[model samples]
Target chain A: MQAQTQRYSVLMVDDDPEDGVLVQKAIASSGPKVDFQFVASGAEVLDYLFTEGRFTDRSSAPRPNLILLDLNMPGVDGFSVLKQIKSDMDLRRIPVVVLTTSEAETDIVKSYDFGANTFITKPSSFSDMIEVMTSLKSYWFDAARLPTA
Target chain B: MLAIYEYLFGAASFVPHGYCLAWRPDLIAIHALSDGVIALSYFSIPIALILLLNKREDLAFKRTFGLFALFIFSCGVTHLTAMIMLWEPYYGAQGMVKAVTAMISVVTAISLWPLLPKVLALPGPGQLRKMNTQLAAEIAEKNAAQVNLHQAYQQVEAQVVERTRELQALNQRLQDDVRRRSLLEEELREKAAQLIATNAELERFAYIASHDLQEPLRKIQAFGDLLKSEYETVLPDEAVEYVRIMQNAAYRMNKQTKDILTLSRLSWDSIQFDSLDLAEVVEEVAFDLKERIEEAGGKLEVGPLPGIPGDRTQIRLLMQNLLVNAFKYREPDSIPEVHVEATLHDTGAPGTGGACVEISVRDNGIGFAQEDAERIFSIFQRLHGRSEFDGTGIGLAICKKIVENHNGAIEAVSSLGKGAVFNIRLPTSQPERREIHAGTDTAV
Candidate 1:
């Protein structure tokens, strides 16, 4: 749930630094209070989500309200991460958005099949990316209702 | 009896024939001359008979002729005896000669009587001549028949020789046909092997294009976009322009790789065909391109279309590329007008011909040169520079591949400066799907 005083959190898992930074900038531009977090690999995302390994301290690993996932990763790919998150009762309630460079139909269908809330192909232009971020923020933060964390 | 025997042997009757004529000179002379002439005549007749018998030795009655000769000689001896009797009265000798002649005459008569029927049975000269003529006629007829038989045999031999020659020629042609067919089979086998190798290579290329090649290009574009969006104010106008150019290059490369990937995928992907209304497909394509069309101030007119069997996604891409190409190549300061229409050609009444739908995409845009119609449907074949028309030059090639994927044909007809028409012929029914050999596992 969105509250005026509490800042919402978002987590993105991507292997590419360039894509991560661009999405970070877009998220920053879209919302001032959004706590956007970046994990470089699927393993790190799992670590951060379960509060294990380097993120073992409960205070350091804040549970995210939404997850932005990239399907192609070096090890423990986004599909496996998505499957694990959706199957876990504690993590299943969190919304997942699949964002990837691939515009392949198979990827889109598979992402939805794995219980992803939305699928977005990564826009090439900064302006288009900003638009996607703005609309995502408006829909998730302002229009649609979510269960309280 | 003793006195008679003595009288027969003794010369007591020895007397001259002249004394018997009473010693007259004229009478004696006449008797002697007549007897001498008669004797000479009788000897000459026997000699002539002997000569006749010797000359005609093949005569049928040779024994009869010998008997006749003997009888004549004996009679001659008797006549000579008479002549002697006229000179010297040797009556006993004369009687003996007459007796021998009488005996020979009696034997000749007996032999002649038995030979009479045989001599009568011998053919006459006229009958012999008639038989010779008949034999000659029969011989002539047999000779003519023999000649005819020989000619017929020759004609049959000639025909056999001719038929043998014809059979030999037919065998030669059949052997040549077999050899040609074997050569064709060998060529086909080699082509099949080459196709396998080429398909493998295409699959490798598609994997590289889809993932590895697009990766760095995407990064380059993303960073360039960031620089332009975030640091444009701090950067000089020239720097900003450089960034924009770099992004544009990266974008174009990405698009080119994507198109290459699509073309490669079309080659090896398994297609599942569905019964689709082509009108609905075209309408969907038009709706997706609505904003672009409105931006170009274009008008799209769709006519009635038939249902055909095709891959839905591929067909959608095919229509999208065609419409975009029509609008992209439009003349400056003119509204882009694209028309989509289809006509059914039910040629399946004859089983050899397939019923098909001929869909034509006509555009009132800047058409290409007539000679370049075939070249336009080849990948990366650009008709204009990038600045003149923003294109990767793979749209028509993709269209061609899509049409071919549906087991169809496509052709473009146009003149320079005239509107172009792209005619696509698609069968109403899909052909049986052939199983393609899977590529290497490493390929994406």
Candidate 2:
């Protein structure tokens, strides 16, 4: 079969601006071309996903093909956001990958229990970060098939 | 004897031969009255003696007193006869009565002669009074002694009552002390449980802090790497060197945070123990370190290892850390050789005490000083500089923590240039589930 050349979009939620910039740069450095959007906190992730408030223009803010969720934030943390996404009929089909600095077993287990697709610890070096992004892109975009968006 | 009795009877004639003296009424009355009074007095004395003797069965010398009473009675009869003759002639009867009285007197005198010495030896009334006074004095002394004894008895009884009361008071105090101690112990137990929960919470916080702290450090290192690689051609050499230094520091900080997280994660509550074959753990560790072992030209000889109760992942990590240490710290000219051996060791004697699995990992490495053997297990304690060996200095500390979580003991023995041997003793049976309670007062 011919390789499906479908473009994908990712919504990343993180409170730290530096971490968000680093992840974007690392993904851009690595090959797979993906459209990325950044939201500061978990509450903004829900608004962006449902096209509410500032994200009311659904055409301009496209639905994310995948969600990169951070666990710790000021309000409405990643766990609750994940719960809201997985429980909603419109957003349950979207794959949610938890990317956080916490390597705690409880965090990993809780993310999975809340219907996260994958849990990955953010790598500490540029090389390691690139390697992780490469693997994530290959597995989600190429190997696994997604529902119609 | 019959003829004498007849003569005595015929002698009772009324008159004698002539003695027509003056018969004066006054003289007659006086004489008869005096004789009658004397006779009555003597008769009363004998009757009283008879009554006394009859009444007092324990009275001494009964026959002698009877003889005295009879003699007195005979004398009274003689007086009576004399009085009767003064009134009537009766001279023959009077003469006969006199004769009888004389005979009785003679017999009484003879009997009295024998009893006279005995009567004379008896105590007089005056002497008896003196003896009675002495006896009364002795009785008074005895009564006084008896009173003193009764007083002493009362004092002793009082002392006993006092002692009993004191003992009861002491017993009550002891009971109160025991109750107070138990209450304090219960409160202490509750405090200990609370302390353990707080300690667990603190550890969790440490883990979270270390984990979260690594994120920014990671970003710094990544950006520094990107800056270096992307601008290597355009940037000056000094800027590249600065980036290199920044990246190195970031890398070290990252490693330290990771080690801290590992240390905090080594908690007993999170460990699950099972019967594990340590040889399998060693094999896996060796496989994982195959490249390093081959590069170092190391020989790992693993002997028959016994099964012990322990957390599988922690035990694997412990073996890996030790093996890596053995491979890393080798003599300059010597080939690395590590011998891992396990044996069943009885704490006391066979079948007497608990059985333990004694595991020894001996390495042919450049050994540390003897004093540093204990210090090596402390976190971030390094004997050599970072140039000599590259490590976070947390491997042995993690190993120690893992062994402690298994309720086991671990120690290292080493001398300069003689290599090091690590001995681990683990119970074959499951260790008791230990709850992390607060420390005791003494421990605190």
Scored against the true structure, residue B380 in model 1 reaches a CA lDDT of 89
The digit string of per-residue lDDT tens for model 2 on A1-149 reads: 22657778888899987878877887797776899899999889889988898999997688988889988888899899999999999899999999887776778888899999999988878888889888887787878888876
Model 2, B1-444: lDDT tens digits are 766555544434544222232556666677778899998998899999999999999877788778778878888887887777675555555667778778777777788788878888888898899989998999999999999999999999999999999999999999999999999999999998777878667666666557656766787788998887789899999999999989888888888877776776675246667878888889999999999888877899999987777888889999999999988897666899999998887782223357778889999899889999899999999999887888999999999998887767889999988889999877777644444332211100
lDDT of 1 by residue, B1-444 (tens): 766655544556566666778878898777767777877777787788788888987788877777788888888787777666666666766787788889989999999999999988998888889988988988999999999999999999999999999999999999999999999999999998888888888877777777778878877887787787779899999999988888899999989998888888877877778888888999999999999999988999999888888889899999999888888887878999999999888863123368888888999888988899899999989989999999898889999988888878888988867889999888888766634545542413
Q: Second chain TM-score per prediction?
A: 0.56, 0.64
Q: How close to the true structure is residue B419 of candidate 1, measured as C-alpha lDDT?
A: 84
Q: Each candidate's TM vs. the true structure?
A: 0.64, 0.72
- List lDDT for all candidates, in order: 0.84, 0.82
Which candidate leads in DockQ?
2
Point to the candidate with the largest lDDT: 1
